[model samples]
Target: LAKTTQPISMDSYEGQEVNITCSHNNIATNDYITWYQQFPSQGPRFIIQGYKTKVTNEVASLFIPADRKSSTLSLPRVSLSDTAVYYCLVGEVGDMRFGAGTRLTVKP
Candidate 1:
């Protein structure tokens, strides 16, 4: 199992960019880093993913270093609606596991 680590919480204001980082010291060569956003009572929502370097989508951008030991999820111009728990999973598609996650609170 690929264990992950992340900040317990983060605070941001509306219209600001928020970057949350996750660390996985033992990430395997075939492992993929995927991020998810979840609201209070909702399931996790896929945001962005990357195996290495960087990957960007309409929602966010995921950046991974060449070493692949860590990754950052960057959310641009976030709003209050973006306030949620962000999860980082490491490993293959169906074998991925979630850490505690980073609770992001976007203030107006």
Candidate 2:
């Protein structure tokens, strides 16, 4: 499994967009960039993922650079209820490990 490094925190106001980028220069060939969003006491929820290019769903958009060394998760129109921790992990589902994540503060 490849290790990922990203921000420890980010701040934004309600109705604003937030984009978080992660760097994994040592990302493995079989590894995938996955983003998770965690509310205070709850477990993280899958936000988006991609090995390359872009992927967008109901919640957010994932943008992976061509080199595969970095990726970004874009949240459209965040709200105070969106305050949470965001994590970027690189690896297979079962092979991944959780670490202290970036705490995101969405102000009203």
lDDT scores of the candidates, listed in order: 0.93, 0.87
TM-score of each: 0.95, 0.93
Candidate with the greatest TM-score versus the true structure: 1
Instruction: State the TM-score for model 1.
Output: 0.95
lDDT of 1 by residue, 22-97 (tens): 9999999988898999999899988887899999999999999999999999999999999999999998866777
Candidate 1 lDDT trough over 10 residues, lowest sum? 91-100
**Residue-pair clashes, model 2:** 0
Candidate 1 steric clashes: 0
- Judge candidate 2 against the unseen true structure and give its global Cα lDDT, from 0 to 1: 0.87
> Candidate 1: how large is its RMSD?
1.0
Tell how far residue 64 is off in model 2, in angstroms.
0.4
RMSD of each: 1.0, 1.1
Question: Model 2, which residues run further than 4 Å from truth?
Answer: none
